[model samples]
Structures are given as structure tokens and as C-alpha cells.
Target: MKEGNAISDAHQVTAWPPIRNLVSDMLAISQRTHNGYGLLEFDVTTPLARIAEHKTRMPDGISFTAFLAYCLGHAIGEHPGVHACRQGGRLVVFDDVDISTLLEKTKPDGARVPVIYIVRAANRKSLAEINEEIRRAVRDDLYDDPAVRRRRRIVRMPALLRRGVWWWIRRDPVRRKRQWGTAVLSNVGSAIDARPSWGLVQSFLPCSVTVGGIFERVCWRNERAEPRKMMSVTVAVDHDIVDGVPGGRFVARFAELVEAAAGLDEEFGTSAGDRAEGQSR
Candidate 1:
């Protein structure tokens, strides 16, 4: 492959000690388990309906990103292994919810590079912060900066060369521990317009699981009506973390929460009395 300045430049090297340690730990765990890989899938129609309804009015307020984060946190809280990585026969489960999302931005010339980051304490992050972090990572050129690119190259080097390079980079303990997170979130919805049929996504080794959203077509039947708005949502997940039962339950609960939140306006009364009360308070 003909390498460009973005790929071969030395300045591209930056310290990412945490990511290195995480990879090392994961490798160790995989080596210990008889079957290092696992998979799971479920249908979340109910939850999707609830989420869609809740977001109908406040489209910007209740977003897909926030919903995904909430669901992931809920699932991980119940099943800790969902956020665990294998390290040489031992499974290391993280205490906090650190989610890594992929970001791709167009450059002046139109080329794009995807970068990933650890969104600190994703469970507690507000809708705005989640959106802003994704925006900042994509717009700041942090992914393409010379230093970042160099570090990526070194990390991706052949196994033989990687040992020495990675060792030198890991001298900083803070960097090494900083990168480990409970799980990863991949949004492939940007590629397709419509939601896809519910299914599990296949991904690489190191990553224990992956989730994707697809186009959805939903119709509402009324007494005199035929069809309603064409709407959809995307879903992606790793199978190894949880079994069918728990996965289904998680999806069901998620749907319930979204649905309940959506009906808040109607339940609280959108009538004149409600309006007057609002004015009084």
C-alpha cells in the first residue's frame, strides 16, 4: 500500500497507554476461556415503539444516542459481563460505563477518517454532552492529527514490531488504565436511510460485542384510518454478553421506559387546567 503523510509521518505518534493495556488484558482473558467468542440477539419492537413516541415531540431532546446509552447502561448494570473484557483466562469487569463511539467527518478535500474515544461516564452524561462529545471528536481533527495517526500506525503494526513499540508507549500507567471501558457502540445508521431488520452484527475478535441500528417501517391502525407515519430505529449488539432471555427482557424494559416517558404529556393533562397550573407555578 502506498502510504500518505497522514499514515507514515512520525509525529502521528501519541500516547494511548490505556488502550494498549486494555488490548493486552483482553488478549490474556481470551487465552484462558475455552471459547473466547459469544453472540446474542433479540426483538425489541415494544421498546422501539415507546422510544419513537417519546421522541415524537422533542426530537432533539430525546435522541437515538441518549436512548442507546441508557439501554446499554441498564443492560450492563444487570449483567456485568456485558461490559467485561477477557484477559488471559480472567475476565475483568469495569466499574464504570465507558462507551467508545465511532466518528467520521468530511475534510475540506472530502476524505474522511474514523476515530474512536472513551466517553467518560456515559451513563451519567446528559443528552447534550453526548451529542457534543461526538461532534467535538469528529470536528477537531483529533483523529487525523499527525500525532494521533502515528500512534495508530504503531499500535496496528505487525505483532513482532508491536511488542517493543507498545511497551515503550505503556511506560505511562495513567495512559494504560485510562482507555479501558465497559463496552463499544457502533452506529452504522449513518450509511443507510431506512432501519434494517432486527439482527446481530458480526465484528472482529478483541471486541466482545457490537450493536447496530437499522431502518424500521411501522404503521398504526386506527378505527377509520389506513396507515400513519413511516418511522424506524436501529439496533446492534454483541451476542456473547447475555442470553436470549435477559436480552429480551432488557429490550422490553427499554421499550416500557421510552413509552412511559412519551405519554408523560398526555398523562399529565394537556388541557386548559394543566396550562393554568403551569402559569400559576
Candidate 2:
């Protein structure tokens, strides 16, 4: 079959579901179960301060990205419901953790496009591997490489032309299988700045849970009035999957894990002992 014809058939098989219906159903079930919607924020000043103090010599050099992904996976493993998706008015929870990292590819003319892929059985990947995959996906060279461009061109037509194709392709019964996962991670850390005023949730995706990592800021203690580095994390979740209490609990547990990992002397190969020796100067 021709490529266009194949895409058309796939879209027909994989019809996108309505967001409001799914959200409402989830909310109703959660309410019946006494679950509530929730949002939680954390202040990482102290942990960051501790990391910076030992950075000179102990540079295990783990990037913040790696740490964030590990924390996300750990949290999902602890809170299973946080990784659920709505399927035919029912909640389908995934057993594995597959965090989708969003990437923006810059074309020759400067237009940036987003592409997503599931990192199969992601919980099995180590911190270094996760970090490397993310780096490779975002690299301009990877996006612009001749071979890469050729492959994309052959497989993906312009969105305008592909719409009808996608519609038909999605209609296939088998193609409609749920793309559920434990959670979704959006690393906006590169755009580090003040907390964003707003963000839009993608309407047709299987992401019931989403987390955004914003710019790191300097946090200060109240009484001591000391300055410390910190990063802000924003989580937007489907009200249907989890209620406020459980949501808050999940965030708290996730934060604790991040804090502990951040404080590790051997994280990213940097040792506290090595840093202490250098600080002696």
C-alpha cells in the first residue's frame, strides 16, 4: 500500500477519544471512591545548596534532567493510580513506567516541531541512559542530519496533508489500543525563568499525569535570610485518576525521594569526600 494510503487507514482505526468525557468519568469514579484533585509544589533550596557546596571536586556531574527522570519513575512505582488512563469509561492502569520526554526539533528554516516516543519499559533504563537519550533527541544535528531528514520525510508528510491519513489510520480497532503510562515528563528547565503563568494540556493524548520542570531560582530562608538555589516543578494531573489527598501524598513521597537523591554524595559519580578535600583549601 502507498504510504499515504497506509496512514489514512491507520487514522481510521485509531480515532482520538474525547477529553471532557474521559475527564468527567474519571472524576465521577474518583469522587465515589472519595478521591480528590490536588496540586503540590516543593522548595529545593536546601538540597541544591548542599549539592553546589560539593560540586567543585566531586562533580559526579549528573545533570538535573537525569535526577528528575529518576525521581518521576520512582514516584510512579510508589503510586500506581497516578499512572492510569481512561479507556471506554473505565480506568486502565499501566504496570510499567514509560515516561515520554517531549522534544522540539529545529528545522533548517527555524520552525520547531514536537515529536514524542515511548521509551519502552523505561524503568529498566539507568540514569545515564535516560539522560543520553534525551540529549540525543534534542540535538540539532540529530534533527538536521541528512539521513534523519530523509527518513522523516518519507514517513511523515506535512500535517495538513496527513490529517485525513491519520483519521483513517486511527479507526482501526487494533490501532486504538491505549497508550497508557505511569506519568509524563516535560523538561522546561532549559527555559528556566519565573514560574509560567499558564500551560495547556494536550487534549487527545493518553497522559493522565503530567509534570513540568521549570527554571531554577534562588530560595531564601525566612529567619536566616540566606540565599539558596532551587528549582520549581509543576504537576498537572487528571482529576479523574486520583483525588486531592492521594495526589498530595504522591507529590510528597516523590519530593522526599528527590531530596534524598539530591543529597547523595555519590550521585552522578561525584563524591562528597572528594568535594570536602577540595573545600579544605
Candidate 3:
């Protein structure tokens, strides 16, 4: 066929059969059940630019997703009570800061698929450790877990059974904490198909943080408009577990950590106790 010429050979068009996955199940739960929300956006202009330079000099470059998750975990660890979940008319606050994050795994055929993995006690891990864990998630076949396999089958059941299972899982505070962690985190900065610098995201969880794309813009600095790199971030919290003051404090601390992200080596050796001490000082 020549350029701009339409050639018809009577090819059949078909749709891919619907298949149930964990993301869809979670997305359904997020959309239908989640009610309370508190949002905060950060002006991460200079910090992101510095991180870009650091990435260039490294052999195994650090991704913004990994950095973002570490900072979130640290902040949550410091204020664990604020990320609590309420169930059975009781508030369950977690002391250990675990995080659920998404990774784009590449298949043998070079196709990419997103998989959810939990970073247990992420607040205790260093920046290097967190980065390695995220990379391992991309390399490993995480969906091979027996429980995940079982859930795949369970999702195919009737709607009534599905709802019942969802309720059973969600209603129990311990089970909910084990499966979904204290918070869910994601970064759409590299999502080429999404809108430039996508800001907020809605999901059903105790806490959620999402990092959007980086853009360059002119903003007032010393009463003059100057160009700078900027990134948008969104944090959402469920009201049942935490009040507005705590949530606001958590967001403020998270923004402070993100702004200091460019100096990552100091962040690497600090344990949870060290972080607490630094914050106190």
C-alpha cells in the first residue's frame, strides 16, 4: 500500500478476553468503598533536577519511584499512628511501616506489566536497600506466590462470592494490614501515555502517595520569573483512622524529606532510630 492509501483485506478484529487481576480487584474496591481524602502537592523543582544529575553518574541509576517510596516510608514510620486503619469500631495503628508499591515488570517477550509488591518494614531499610528491592521486583516473578495464584482463581467466581471475599478481607484489621500494608505508593512520572505531570490519584487504602511527571516552568524567584524543573505529588489519607492535623503534619514532613532527596548518601546509612533522632534534633 502506498502512503495515505487504505488497503482492505477483510481482516477480522477481535477484543482480548477479560481476565481478572489483583489491580482490578483493588481498583474496584478503591473506587466503591473509599470515602475520606486529604491531598497535598509538593514543589519538587530543584530536588528533582539534582536527582537527575545524580542518576547520570551512577552505574545502576536510582529511579525517582524508589526514592519517593523510601521518603514516604520514612515519614510514615515517624508518624505511624496517622496511617492507621479503622475496623470493627476500633482504630488499629501499625508501628512497623510497611508499604505496597507497583513495579513494571518486563516479560520474556519484552512486554511490560505492573505487579504489586509489599516492602515489609520499609522504614528500616536504607535508600540502597530500597532501590535494590524495587529492582528485584522488576526482575522477579512475584505473582508466583501460592496465595496470589489462589486469589486469581477466586476472582473468577460469581459477584456475590467476590463481594463476600472482599468484605471478609477488608473488615479484619490485621488481614487488611497484612495484605495491603499501611499505605500504597506509585509514580506516574515515567508514564508516557498519561497527561504531563499528572497530579492526584484516588485509591482505597489507609494512605496513598503518587508522584507525577516532571515539567519545566517559569516561576517567581526573588521577584523574577526563572525556569525550574517541577514535579507534582499527591498524598491521600482515610479519615476514619487519622484526623486532619496528623495527616497535614505527615504531608509536611514528607515534602521536607523529598526536598532533601538529592543528598541520598546520608539517607542510606540512617536506621529508623537514627532518623528519629535527627528529626528530634
Candidate 4:
């Protein structure tokens, strides 16, 4: 009731970190781009099963994010136009599918932050390689690099100077791809306790994907309702480069690959008995 009573609520002010500032800058820039958003669901039962099976051999285990990266790379390889960036009057499409993913790390002060790691030539790498790379990035301090350090310095600069750096990067497709990668794939699902249906992500990259947690649902199959694992995936593409048709085709192909569990067997060496058993099933 009194002013003094309202002050009883507890709060503390912490200075915003450089990483947070950088993310804010990226969002501010991405807002200017024409972005098309799509919220879609995929059946991930097959991939989960396969990942569990493969974990018997892989002690560290494979992650669902790695599987998604595998599927996304292949999808982009099939539809490269979806990740093209406009350069003057022409569009620049890179042959390699470099995917930038965020890895959360805790600082010495115990503050958690997300760091970007690019999986170079993701389209050409096997699922196991991708899984190992992600695991290695988490296990070691590789996520902290000179480039990120440079970014930390950039974020500390004045807002106008920081924005100038981003503008310079955005103007050239080659520099942008080399620095930030051709696409972004972030998985926020694994970190949270409760499953989220969907989440929107902003990025300066041409294509960005946000992978959400899985929820069980019933789907009509063989004239009967069957329980299935479903995940919400949000995709945003730069309309300046990616058109509606190509973007739709890319999304459809990505869904098909994910539903089919396209690359599970390629992750590791499977015994003949295991293959035969899988075939029988």
C-alpha cells in the first residue's frame, strides 16, 4: 500500500554482456530484411529410435541436433537456392552447406551464453562426423576463438560502429558466408524441461531454423490412430534471395528426409546381424 512496502520486492541489475549486445544488434539488423516464416511439425520417432540404437556403440552418443543438421544440409544441397544471398543484381549460392549453430556455455562468473559454431561443408559430412564435431565443441574450449573474441571487442564499440561492422558484413555475400555461414540451425528444445510448441528466431543469415522440443500426439495411420513423436520446427528465410516456391520445396524435402530417418545407418559401422535384424523389423 505504501511506497516503502512496494520496495520489498527483490531485484538486481547486471550489466549486459557483449554477447547479448551482439545478439541484440543482429536482431535489429534482421528486422529490416524481408523474412518469411513457416511453422511445421515433423515425426521424429524414427530418428530417436535410430539414435538410441547407435548410442550403444557411441559412448558419447549422438544428438538430435546433429541429425537435424544432417537432414538440413542434404536438403540445402538439393535446393541450394533457398540459401542464396543477394549480391548486387546477382545471387550468390555457395556449393558447401555451412551451418552455423549455437552452443551454450557458462562463463567463469556462472552466466550462461550462446556461442556460434559453424559446421563447414555440412552437406558433405556424415552424421557421425557432425555428432562428433558438436560433442567436441562442447567438450573442449574450441567455441572460444579469435573471431568470437573479435566480436566481443566489436560489441563493446559504440552502437553506430557496431552496426557499421554488421552492415559491411551484410553487404557482401562471400564475407557473410565465410564469417556467419550459409544458414543457421539452433536447437532450444534440449535445454528446456517443458516442451515448447514453437519459437521465433531472428538472424542475418539467409536461412534460419529453430528446433523445438518434441511432444507426443496421435496421428491417423492405417485407418487407426497411433501415437507419434512430433517436433515443432520454425524456419525463416530471407525473401530477398529465397522465393516462395524454392523455400517451400526446401521445407518439404527437409521434412521428407527427417521423417525417413535418411542417414542413421551411415552414422557408424553396423554388423551384418544388426542389419539383418533391422531388415527383419
Candidate 5:
């Protein structure tokens, strides 16, 4: 046979990072996790407008993701059962709403990787506080984070030992919270393309949220059709721990909060309607 051109085809095979195994381990745990997902769409025109205006005043720009995180925290606080993890015969529920999210960080070699960042006591934090925290994490060298360092060591172990470590961690709710978090919020849409879509994300946490894109859509208001900004979001909870009644309630309350721009009005003193009125004149 003549020499084939297959060898000339450009292809690069990169070594898989050990840390990816950590995510794989988490996905493996999800096999045993029974999750009920609520795919929701929220009218975020007010919040987006408010966030845009707030950015002009504050040096640290407001993040829509942070606002959603704030809303998720309070919502979980009201329905604590959604954040409860099952430990053998009993259920372990936590009051503090700890949200674990992945923020991209650049390594010294200039390779970008997602680093796990936990927003502790998210319920008690204000919008500005959450915004600044997220911004700071983006600026910081997250590879130096102690939690990331510890996780690096864990990923280096043999596959069996690594799996065993995760099992041991999951056995105790407190341990899981300390190591992973009580809940997870993955905002994949915000960081990626502008395509408006809902992401169905899987996680090992008791409660998880996947925030998608904001796109303009026609909505009926006062029997008149008007263009409004809509956001795609998904809220998931462990079905074994959280029932439908409470889960539905949590989604309702969360939608109401986001649609009404709950945290923004308290800080900004006006709604999108009010801002539009001033600009019109």
C-alpha cells in the first residue's frame, strides 16, 4: 500500500488532568443521587436593568449570577428541606446556605481551569458583598486556594482510594458541606455564548441550580404584548429528601423574588419602570 495521509492530519492529544477525575467522581456519585429538576423561566428585565445601572455607580460591577445566587440562598433558607442530605436513617438539614460554584482560573502556564469556590452563608450576604466576592475570586490565583490544593492531592491517589475517599466524605453531611458544600449553583450560560438555553446540570449536592442565558421574548402584560427579558434556569433537589410541595413552593418564591428584583430595590431605591420613566422625559 502507498503511504497514507492519516499521519499528516493535525491532531493534538493532551494528557487528562487528574483534577478532572474529581469531577468524574462527583458525577459518579450522582448515579446514586435522586434529583427532581424544575426548568423555569423568569422575567429578569428589571434585575438586568438595575444591574446595568448599578454598575455605573459601583467600582465592582454587579453580577446577575451573584444576584441569582443571592435569591437561591434565601429561597433555600425558607425551604431548608431542599438542602437536607440523607445520612442513613435520618435526614441532616443545614440552616446556613453554602453555595458551591466553579470559577475559571488561569494557571501559571496560562491554561484556564475551573476552580471550586464556595460562597459561605450566602443567605446573609448583601448583593454588593456577593458581587465583590465573586469578582475577587476571578482576579485571585485560585490554584493557590487551600481547598484546591487539598483536592489536587486527593486526585493523585489510586482510583479505588479516591473513590473510597469520596464515599467517606458523603457519609457525613457536615463533612460533605465542609469539603464540597450544602448546595451547588453552576452558571454555565453566563460564561459561555449568548445562546439562550436552559442547562440541565447534575451535581452531588442536595440542592443545585443551573443558570442559563437572558434573551428577549414577547410577554403579555395588561393584555398588551411587550418585549421582556427572560432567563432560563433549572433548580434541582434530591427527591428522596425534598417532596414536591416544598419544592414547588421554593420555585414559586424564588421566581417571585427574581421577577420583583427583591434585593435590587432595597439597595437601588427604584424599579426598571421608574428608571424608564426618568429616561423617557
Candidate 6:
């Protein structure tokens, strides 16, 4: 941040406000409670192919976040227990499948900052609708995003008091369910380290899913070597809320829904280009 520092050095020295607030808030959530978590990675090659086809056929590129939310939403819908939290005497299962996810946007200073967004009732929305929502979340600058507002508000609070407020938000089941949601997803598909594999993360939530980079790999099908596009998906479930058996089942269900997504042309009738053209006229 010095007047003449090199770009890399300056970036290292500068702690962007938005990203700092995000980390601070996440730390508060981590401190709220402890949950036994396990990581499971799935080879989601089949559905990835379907997603690729859908992308090619659609005029407006679809957001991977939208596709993921659709798949995860349906899977959670079938197993509502995954989104439930235990109270003193009862379990509270939210009917809506709200998904909290991380997104990166360029700050006014030209540095990229990570922001959190929650897609409420994802199970109730179609793929097209989810796609539009994510597009709007990123593209529309007419209104401040919820994450931006929260970051602005939190940054104004004293550090000592901010953590307390965040802890309070996470501690309340109703508020947490509404704001942070039952399941969490982080998209790391774009940041592929040439390390030969994906990263596994155990988020402080009932369930957390991370989608890693998609790369071409050799596959041996019917004794023939062929190249196939494959991606890594890590799903972590709270052991207290979901046991291994159900956890495995949930992952399998998510994979099934992703692979089973069909008829992109029929699902999305209008192309993004067409919509834009109509708007311009």
C-alpha cells in the first residue's frame, strides 16, 4: 500500500477490507460450536458432461454455481433430514433448501474479494431461475448485495463487538437457518493448482460441498483407454447430524441428480442473447 511498492508486494501488504471481514465472520462461526465432520470425494464425470452439453446449447453461459445449487437442492429435498438441527427436545428441519456459497468479485480497488451469498429455497427454483439469480447477484449493481451490506456494517463495529454479534447470529437456529442456511457450497473450480488433485475442506455447517477444477484425464472403459473430462467434488457432513450411511447416500443422490439433468433446450426456452436483443430494442 506504499506509494512506490511493487504490485505483488503491495497486494501482500494490503488486507482488503471485504475479505478481512469475511474471514473474521467465518472465524466467529467456527468458534460458535464444534461438529464432527468427514470428507467424501466423488468423481462427477458423467454429470459434468451433461453440464457441458447444456452450456454449449444455451446462448447465455450458465453459471456453474447455479447448476450445482440445482443438483444439491434436489438431493437435499429428497433427504430433508440433512438440513435439520437438533434442539433440546426436538429436531428442526427447514423446509427451504437455502444454500450459502462463496463468490469472488473485484473490489473498487481492483483486488478480488470473496463474498458470501445465500440462495434461498433453491429446491423450489428451476435451473434457469437459479442461473438468472446468480447472474443477477454478480451482474446487477443497481442494489447493494447482502454480503456487501453486512461487510459494510460489520467493518464499522469494533472487533470485540463484531465477533459477539456474529456468534449470536450463528447461535440462533432460526436466524442461522435464514441467513447461513442448512448447507454450504464453495466453488473452487476455477483455481486449479497443478498439484494433480483437489482440495478437501470441512466447513462449519451441517453439510458442505466444494467443487474443484475439471480436467481431462485418461479413462479405461471397456478395456479401451480414452480421455474424459472429470472433476473432483468434496462433500463433508456433520457426523452428529448425519451418520456415515446417510452421508454416503446423500452424496450418491447428488451425483444421480447431476447426471440425470436432461433436456436443456426444453428447460431454457430463451437464449441470453435473445433476451439482451429484446431489451435493447
lDDT of 3 by residue, 1-281 (tens): 46677776788887542344455666778775454554444667756665666556454556677778788889998888767777767788877777888777777898776666778787887776777677767666877865456566766777678767877888887787776777888877677432345455656677888777666667788999987666666677876666779888888888898877623753443432254344359
Error of 5 at 81 (Å): 0.6
Tens digit per residue, CA lDDT, model 5, 20-132: 89988888888888899998888989988887877675555576778888898888888888898888899888879999988888878989888899988898887666766
Whole-model lDDT values for every prediction: 0.47, 0.52, 0.70, 0.83, 0.82, 0.70
Query: Residues 41-77, candidate 6, lDDT per residue (tens digit)?
Result: 4445665565576667555567877888988988998
lDDT of 4 by residue, 135-164 (tens): 777766753576677677788999999999
Model 6: CA > 4 A from native: 1-18, 31-48, 193-196, 262-265, 269-281
Indicate whether candidate 2 or candidate 6 has the larger TM-score.
6
Best by lDDT: 4
Rank list by TM-score:
4, 5, 6, 3, 2, 1
Across 70-144, the per-residue lDDT of candidate 1 in tens digits comes to: 555555555555445444466566666676655665767886655555666765654345544554565476756
Per-prediction backbone clash count: 32, 33, 0, 0, 0, 0
Count of clashes in candidate 2: 33
- TM-score: which is higher, 2 or 3? 3
Report the alpha-carbon TM-score of model 6 versus the true structure. 0.81
Ranked candidates (lDDT, high to low): 4, 5, 6, 3, 2, 1
Q: Cα-based RMSD of the predictions, in order? A: 10.3, 12.6, 6.3, 5.0, 5.6, 4.9
Better of 3 and 5 by TM-score: 5
What TM-scores do the predictions have? 0.53, 0.58, 0.79, 0.89, 0.89, 0.81
* Model 6: pairs clashing at backbone N, Cα or C within 3 Å: none
